[model samples]
Target: MKTIKIIFVITFALAGLTLSCESISNPDPINAIDSTQTATIQGTAYANMDETNDTTFSTKENYERAPQGTNVKVVLNSRDFASNIEPGVDYKSLTYETTVNSSGDYSIEVPALGDPIDAEIYFDSFKTSQTQVDSTEEQRNYSPQQFPYTVRISAGLSTFNDAIYNSN
Candidate 1:
């Protein structure tokens, strides 16, 4: 009976690892067979885009007047978030970070990587929230929740980022 129990546990553990390893699937290529690619990423960052009847100015106007307002910083990673490639020395620093325009429109051109690879942009709201105490391994002392804007952008066949962000 003990032998059977041990065998079952080992089988289950192997199965779990197998499933986890296959969790990340390679997505379709962003561009065709091009030696290089240049694309523009344009989108809006706001608590909400759904315009209510209370606003007098145009939809563009309201977004500019938002208390959260502008200066929202977002980072663009060279590789997909799920890729096994290590960040190495220059990771986040090498990433392309940009600020949204006053009207909430963020337009930036993706640098030429000289190869076909997945590009991803991570936005964490406008401001950075701090933690109460520093205790983590990196000593970040910051709450991931503070960065409420969790949007993953996968480029399409076209050059435009295609208005992916649509939430508070």
Candidate 2:
């Protein structure tokens, strides 16, 4: 009779342990989906031109001209890069491109999975001129200058005012 009681107690304890483990292992489905939502990034770009021709454009006052028609590229990735280092080439990333408007403003909406997303933003500018020899022909020169930087963005609106110095 004592053996029967011992077996019953052991079976009950095992059932309870199994039930508790199953509940803890499962996660809420709604919360899991909400974590991987989207985010929007918007900002204005400026060209820090050396109006005085002195080759100094390190201050905020020098960023007076708007960088119209500049290409603004945003790359979303899982890791953040150093400020001085260029991003997107070495890692798996998603790229989004937009052109700076006439007013120098740009807006891009990108998928930002995880609580906070990592992004690399940069600008590209080109100078196009019509050649005097051929009225219908034009010359395009791509600027080698660009300012690439990284940022940590959330699931809402994030703003960044970027200024790239004019290397002309």
Candidate 3:
């Protein structure tokens, strides 16, 4: 009789343990997709305006007169240069007219949805014969301005993981 009671108690305990180990049904998924994300990427394009004898202008004047290129291209892709750019999506130019402070630095505004798109600003100098005087050398040069930087979107799992891994 004692053996029978012992066996019953042992079986009851095992059943309880097994029931407790079973995971409860959750209405929500363990990893819900996060829709809301916000991030910004900003950097300065460092380039002084073309200063030539034909355009006898101060640094500030030269910067101000410098034709700000309208075609500052922003190329964004989901993969890391693995595939070609996505189609049907239009990329807006991030070029704006702003004065370079006494320290030759220009701020270009690049508005974005959540995070600024990965991009580089190429400042293509527009030369004109009217602006060109007797200086032939000045007319032949094209000052291309380029700035490379990364704009991170808001904190995602991948970003956090990267940060933690990098810190370690």
Q: Of the candidates shown, which would achieve the greatest lDDT relative to the real structure?
A: 2
Please write out the lDDT profile of model 2 over residues 1-168, one tens digit for every residue. 999999999999999999878844552232222434667777766553334433454545544444476888888753332223344435456688988888767888776654666677887766644233223444444442455767777766564646454444
Over 1-168, each residue of candidate 3 has an lDDT whose tens digit, in order, gives 999999999999999999999999754222322335423233333223232442444433333333333223333443322224445544344333334334333443333334333533334344432233333433333344324233443332121100000000
RMSD of each: 16.5, 12.1, 17.1
Candidate 1 on 37-153: residue-level lDDT in tens?
455556665432333332555444443221233433444454433235543523342255566556545666554443344445555433332222232222121112234243433
TM-score of 2: 0.51
- Give the TM-score ranking, best first: 2, 1, 3
Report the candidate with higher lDDT, 2 versus 3.
2
The lDDT for every candidate, in the order shown, is: 0.43, 0.60, 0.37
* lDDT of predicted model 3: 0.37
In model 2, which regions exceed 4 Å deviation?
1-36, 50-61, 78-91, 128-146
Extract clashing residue pairs from model 1.
47-168
Error of 1 at 27 (Å): 32
C-alpha TM-score for every candidate = 0.35, 0.51, 0.29
Model 2 per-residue lDDT at 39: 70
